[model samples]
Target: MALCSKIIEHDDTGRYLTINQIYTEPFPSAAASGKLRVEDNNGIVWILSYRVKSGGTRVFSGDWPRFVQNYKVKAGNTIVIGMNGTGSTDHKIEVM
Candidate 1:
């Protein structure tokens, strides 16, 4: 399948993009169990987890209990997302 992304029109001053919400498809087909990450322009890292919620995958984390998880991505590279639990990963993003 193809990947999709949306641009948020708002001031990102003194902060980074927020992942206020995340949605994935079904497991074994859509859902993935593991670490979710997002790296911004800074040099920080945010990790999260997700499972199928209703009919899509939803991410959650206690370490980053904000509207969004932020980080500083590696230049020339996208943020990296990896699976770290006893399960499979449907997809992944590099948090850098």
Candidate 2:
């Protein structure tokens, strides 16, 4: 599955990346709250924890700061999240 969303202010300072509702809808129930591996454009993998919150689903973890810094992500940037076939571990992300 492939998903895309724009970076927001909170994402840059809160140490959490929000997942859009459209993308979250197709996720398995268990994915609502658990660890997930997200790879960046450079193929660096980050294990982030996700959960459904009042606002939406957010991906976060201790490595969030490093992930953002490494990618030089900023508010207004667009990010694409790609997952290989269902149940696949090859999840990747790209910034544009």
Candidate 3:
């Protein structure tokens, strides 16, 4: 299932992808609280730290910048995060 589909912001390409409260609740258990295994469309697995900041905002940091770099992601691109399968810790990301 798709967790969220968001437009990449300038700051998101810099250090992390910030997800607002509306999108945070659907994340799988592994991604909602700690380190998550995110596999890009290219099948590259990136380890990103997932945390809820004050005010209920969520973020995926750590290697997120690297992922942006590798994909040449930019502002206005649509990024989608979803579960690879039911009850799986693996998540899939696609940039379009």
Candidate 4:
């Protein structure tokens, strides 16, 4: 299932990318306090730290910046994040 399909912004190219709250439910709760594994289209696995802010906003940090840079992600690019199955923390990303 698709977790997020966001148009990248300049700010998003920084240290982290915030997952929209609406899609937070499918994310592994363990990731709420630890790391989530995401495989990019190139088969590279990115270990990203996940956290929930005071108001339930979800964010991914750690290798996210590297992933963004490696993928040449930039403002105006669109990225789709998805999971292979329900309740799966192993996710994938597609850049367009």
Residue-level lDDT tens digits of model 1 in 1-96 = 224332332332123433333553322332343545533224344444434345342434433334233433222323233433322333333332
Selected candidate, larger lDDT, 1 vs 3: 3
lDDT of 3 by residue, 1-96 (tens): 777889988888898899888733666575445888878766678888888777778888888889888989999999998887633346888898
Q: What is the lDDT of residue 34 in candidate 4?
A: 81
Error of 3 at 16 (Å): 1.4
Listed per model in order, the count of residue pairs whose N, CA or C atoms clash below 3 Å is 15, 0, 0, 0
Q: What C-alpha lDDT values do all the predictions have?
A: 0.36, 0.62, 0.80, 0.76
lDDT string, candidate 4, 1-96, tens digits? 787788888888999887566644656653545877877765777788888777777777899898888988899999787884532336887788
Q: Please provide the root mean square deviation of candidate 4 (C-alpha atoms, Å).
A: 3.1
Location of the lowest summed lDDT over 10 successive residues in candidate 2: 21-30
Query: Which regions of candidate 1 deviate over 4 angstroms?
Result: 1-30, 66-96
Question: Which residue pairs show collisions in model 2?
Answer: none
- What TM value does model 1 have? 0.34
Candidate 4 stretches greater than 4 Å from native? 30-33, 85-89
Best by lDDT: 3
TM-score versus the correct structure, for each prediction: 0.34, 0.69, 0.84, 0.81
TM-score, prediction 3: 0.84
Alpha-carbon lDDT of model 1: 0.36
Pairs in steric clash, model 3: none
**Reference-based lDDT, residue 48, model 4:** 81
